[model samples]
Target: MDSPSSSTGPQPIVNSRPGGRRRSILSDFLSDSLPQPSSFLSTSPGIAREILTQDIAECSSSDDDDEQAAASDAESASGPADAKLAFHPNGIVWGAGCSLVPTHSRDRPVPNPHEVEESLHAELSLLRDNAILPPKHRRPRTTNAFARLYRRNFSTKVRDHEGPIVPDVAVETTPMLREIPPTPGPEEIERRFEFAVAHHEIRTTWQREAKTLIQYSTPLIATFLMHYSVTIGSVLTVGRLGLVELAAVNLATMTASITCYVPVQGLATCLDTLCAQAYGSGHKHLVGLQAQRMTWLLWILMVPIALLWWFSEPILAALVPSKETASLAATFLRVLIAGMPGVAMLESGKRFVQSQGLFKATTYALMMGAPLSFLQNWLFVFKFGWGFVGAAAAMAITQNLLPLLLVLYVWLVDGSRCWNGFSRKALRNWGPMIKLALPGMIMIEAQFSVLEVLTLCAGQFGTSQLAAQSILVTVTSTSFNIPFPLAIATSTRVANLIGADLSQAAKVTAKVSIIAACMVGCFNLLLFTTFRDLLPRIFTDDVEVIRIASQALLVCGVMQVFDAIAAVAHGLLRGIGQQAIGSYANLFSYYLVALPISLSTAFALGWRLTGLWAGITVGLLCVSVIELAYLHQTDWEVAAAQAADRLRSEDVAEVKLRRHSHSSYHMEV
Candidate 1:
């Protein structure tokens, strides 16, 4: 009796795949596996099981012409012994049933039904397959056929990520997502709300955190372009004025990049990390108030930024003996000053929105802002009498004012209620904001200050070498900064995961992002090396400018690997909320080590641009090596431990819910 059962058992088993003899058990599988409620659990258990069991094969095939190709393809589900279907983790079809690549199919026969096998990957009849009775109960169907079972993962994909908990009320609906519990403290709610409202000010600020970050970071690559192109174009326009004028531009830009631009980037990044955690937690009042605080703080920073422009004339006059150079430098400062307030606001507003997770909008702003700035530069410098001053002014008008105004208008117009809530009360709880935002700000501010010392030290090398350094640094920064957006994406994604208490998922995402950055590094290195000589010509027509720039670029060629690693680490830090440590690391490595090393090499060792770039390389290398090592060894367990805490707090509620529902009703024990 058992012999026949073994011999004939697999005949229907082979036919169990979708569209294979329309097995009745398919309905039961559908009912059991499709995430239905208890009420409907019994209604169509058999029918549900049958449909689902057979649905894989039952899913419609390709159009007439494509079916053969799909059927005959070595990786298709129905391929022969020599030709197995490629198995995709995401299933065979993503959209419209188009077969995806890289699937794995096996040639094994189905196991005997009554005999149980024990392997995670082993295929046995699940609810849907086992629901229907044997041949004794069913109408006769084909008997001996291939019983090779397609392995099905019967368990639901349990959520692997938990976003940061806040006043956990409503969350954006996502697949297999677990709801974040509301923050435990009433104070947290108020603080978060204030920050959101401040950043979302309808008429004044109104930027979401995510969108703002994207807007600012997306421009990083473009700014690198601006530094290089303007340096080149400015050199040409200053041709009649002489090398001193060109050198003035290099020095001013160096000062700006290190002191104003990059630090501002780091400082505003405070908004990115703090606002995100605060907002994700959904303490609405805190968001509004905190955003205002951040805004005002950055506003005060404008004093120094403006002072940099105002005092620029005298500084250049003292640094360079050339009268024309000093005069031109003063003029550049005036124009930069006019735009300084707006630039700072734009950065501030942008970060406020980005911290809320609006990356798409932020990127769009850059798409709009870059072209306008470039256009103004051409019009003011080349088309008008202003020359370098005109170009510089144009950049200010396009980049500084435009980005600020647009982002501000968006926040004000759309997020009006969010704007009106600012007050001193929101500032009262300084602890969390300081804990989250200050570390990042210090890290960024210190990073820029160090870069400033290095660049200024290089300025002593004269216009050509400084100009070459600027161009080389600009290129390397721009090329590798392409990974910045991905990093931002990674950080936010990981933060949400961490908040959701999904440590494993956070790790995977971080690893993938690092991998992506390294790949980008490879491409950048190749690009710089392949076009090393020609790359500089795009920035300047002067033979000397191009010559020195090329040599620096050649050395800068291999710098991408380290740069990519460091940048990604910075992003990972932001994501994991390790802002202070990263800040400390930047301060320690760049200032304590790289800057001094570069200074010694350039001045003491008699190296010029090579020594300067070598310093940058060494600084970044030190930062990268230490940062990456820390990132790899990060103790994700602390985050995992949060799960136990969550359970300790929320699990009791779940039990009470079950008990309450059970007590008040006729439900059985």
Candidate 2:
């Protein structure tokens, strides 16, 4: 029994090449078992090939008169001059369909309907004869079944006219067709569509998704590295001042991240959903509204956070063994209080632009910020002779400047459509945002607070051990920036494939992602192990600090493999919408399994800084194992079905929203 294509299928796009193609060692028989979503051709690459080949076949025919007659009949019966027909296996034809690609320009025209249909039928028949398409997908030999299947998918108008296809009311009323962009002639669009389609068709699953993952991950990795440079600059500069200063800076940054920065970022992540939904649903102004609301909420929460930072000297003095390090750390936190609002706004602003698909804006802004941050750190700490206070001042100024640069980009270049000046609407819609924000904040803060615990544990040994802990943390963080972002990209692609009901394709993506993670982990392991002694010198001149840090690097180096695989596993969990399970796994592994062992090994057994990292490595290994097992056991078809169900619910809500908006407009008029 053949069914019509799902309404929640992927939207059309002209040319969206993910990256360069590469082949894998996987056998053709194995690769052929994995099937892509029906909508992928329209949205990905293959549709262009179908269009071009069909067009060429019809135009280059031996019978010129028959071709001319067919063309004339199609043109007259096509209804709209911009009508483009795409063929689906179920016999449905899509005409003048809107694209999902976020473009400011007009939509591109495609080949005529009759020509496309004929070409597709010829190709499918050839495939069937050659036994390329799996036996299950081959057309029935009986005419009765063929006619019945065709009747089920096609409109009555298509059967009656037997010329150009026309969509029914249900197809015409789809959200995609509601707001049609202007149309451009065929000459203006790229003719490389067929090339893109062929490239998509020939590649193995591993080869295809690996390239796509790289394409998504490369820029993200760069962005994370630059963003991390802000903290790196402060650590490197302060490490040179003294052992006490190095320990204080790391302690201060870790405390600040746990108590403040992590929460802000985590809370702001709600905008990733809110702003994206608003923009995609045509409620553009809501993007700014959501951002504004988040910013205001963060500012309100920061009131208590500011007070805590301001009077933190007494608290820190009691907590740490060294009074000098505690006082210095307190001073650093106090100076950082001014930068809280900047951090809040930057987090929100990133989501706002990202929601609109303006990803490069943040990258461009950070390109300027990273170098300036390093320069400011050098000038203030060394040139101006402000010491630790100068380092704090530079960090504060840089944080504030990042948001300003992002705003300037939005104002001058693009993404301004979402912003319609400040409005009071941001103040009222507080409940929904807060509910989403708190859970995310708790989860993030829980993960980040582990660093603070590890630092505190290391401090119990002595000042040199504490300083070594700082370097170890920095190296771990910098290494993490690579795999974490790659994981995020993997999650996005996998989730998309799942949503499209391409279970086999999603599985392929998952396998490719884990392999990529393994490769990254090995590279980090090599770098750390090979340069353990030399790497610590880049930060400080102190002999004891360098010696301790170099020793700890051996443990840290081994942790990288588990760390990368664990991160990618977490991403896969998110992609499958099984984040709760991953969260539970993290809590169990880190708290129940890692913390007690670290305290026992570091203090009781006297393994020192190396023992502290060993515990974390154990936790990461457990997380990777547990999550990978869950993924391997997951029923991918069920996951895809759940994703489709979710998409259908969202579509229903969107339709209602449009209807409500239409009614409101009518009432106003």
Candidate 3:
């Protein structure tokens, strides 16, 4: 019998005897010699067999006699013994003959060697002539499953040999398994980061910033509107008494706002910087103490302010020509004096609540007070015939109610977490509070005084002009309420960020606030310009007042844009503890630039109310430009460090004060 190595390729051996031992042996040699199916053919068994048969047939015809004899000898060795089969590269079966018995199994009869050899040779020749082989270049790619499996399992390399595809040990392995992707290097990661920054970073940042501004600004704007509504409701209620009453009450309200109310409000604003920074630094208790200090300071200051209101008659007489109007305005101021403390307290509470981001509490309190003030006015002025004094009394009641309700809410509701009751420490820290409060007060008072100066100029224009100016001022003040709260929100947010040591975030917040302020200004400009003619009808029926007020409104429309910018920029300055900068800007713009121009244009140039507003416009523009420039050039990192230092100093002060108090208590014991 021939050795297994003599087999040239895979072939079936058939016994030709009548009762032949019909067994077959599968040899590994035949599988090793035969061509493997392509990956494409392995997935389609019928096509693979047909192609294989055709290629093998063609190869067999061209093969030499020595090769044929070797195939025949290998087939003759598959007698009674079972053969171990090798798998094709494509995992197909190589031999298709009947099972052969083991050499020790004596029950099976052996087939004739010569007959088996001849039968196998004949079968081999037929299969060789009928089979087909695909070209090497046309083989399956590395991505194919069958090709990968074949490459992994096979020891021999698949290659073309003498016009037929065969397994050869000489060729290097063609790696069929897919190569693993390499990990991204630092350079690649950096490149991707740069791409994101260049393309999407700014847009994402702006969107987040705008959303944050809107979130904080919206509730604050609503709160301002509600607070302003109390005053407006009183104005509307008292207007029904007569034009003289309206003019008198309006003048008194403006005067009081400039001298008393504005200064108190400004003093309370010191809490904006201190409380906001304290809250951001996680010193929540300090925010409450700071607010308490402001409340005490404003109350102390209100003593002098109350005297001013009591003697308002002479001041009004000096400013205006009419004795009757001066007396009426003084009466209005005296009645309004009852609420001045409440206004100051309310402002302090508002700063405290705003620092803790509890804006809704203030909004709800004012919302309740605004309509209630109107109802009280209607009852006192119209129902009881108390006249302009009754309007002032009703407004006082409502204003006082605002602080009471806000204080109750803070003590009982969400904001109580920051409160540790009123501490003696509040009384001891007057220096720091006064330092910030004085500049903030000056900054705010300077701006309000510009309007007061213009109003004084308008009084010189006669009753019609004065009445028109009152209406215009009231309308502009109401509209100014829109951007005013945005400023407060901006200050709170910027201070919080700075105190938290997020300097870049604070800078970005300032920029976004400025942009928002400008946009609001543009919107106000459109609303004021569009409604200029119609808005005066709500305040008065006099044709001359309406005409003059409408013209003034046009100038106000332009001024609102600058007012919006200045308001927000002022808030940014306060956020970084730079209230002195705003104070200086307001002093320079309103006093040096605005007041002189307003006097010249109103008195010298005879431009009347329009010139007054024009001068105010120029002042606002100057303040806005200067504040915006300072904000743009400021180093946020330095500002953050300053905020930290302020907090640390306060802490040190508290520690020293506590030690002194403890030592004094021990000595007393």
lDDT of 2 by residue, 1-669 (tens): 111121111222112235522221122213423332221111111222222223223223324323333443454344322211122111000000000000010011122333244334323322222233322232323335455545444422112222323333232334543543433223222122223223332112344456667866787778778888888999999988989999999889988987888778768766655665455434455568778888999999999999999998888777778888889999999999989989888888887777665667788888999899999999999999999898999999999999999999999998886786786667765775676567667776676667688888887787888888889888888888788777776776666555534455566677778878889999999999999999899888899989999988998888999888888887777776676567778878888888887888888888989888889888888888777766654556666666656555555654555455434434544
Q: RMSD to the native, candidate 2?
A: 17.6
How far off is residue 360 in model 3, in Å? 2.9
Ranking by TM-score: 2, 3, 1
What is the Å distance of residue 198 in model 3 from its true position?
20
By summed lDDT, the worst window of 10 consecutive residues in model 3 runs over 96-105
Q: Is candidate 1 or candidate 2 better by lDDT?
A: 2
Q: Name the top TM-score candidate.
A: 2
lDDT of 2 at 459: 74
Error of 2 at 429 (Å): 1.9
* lDDT of every predicted structure (CA atoms): 0.46, 0.65, 0.59
| Whole-model alpha-carbon lDDT for candidate 2 | 0.65
Off by over 4 Å in 2: 1-203
Worst 10 residues of 1 by lDDT: 92-101
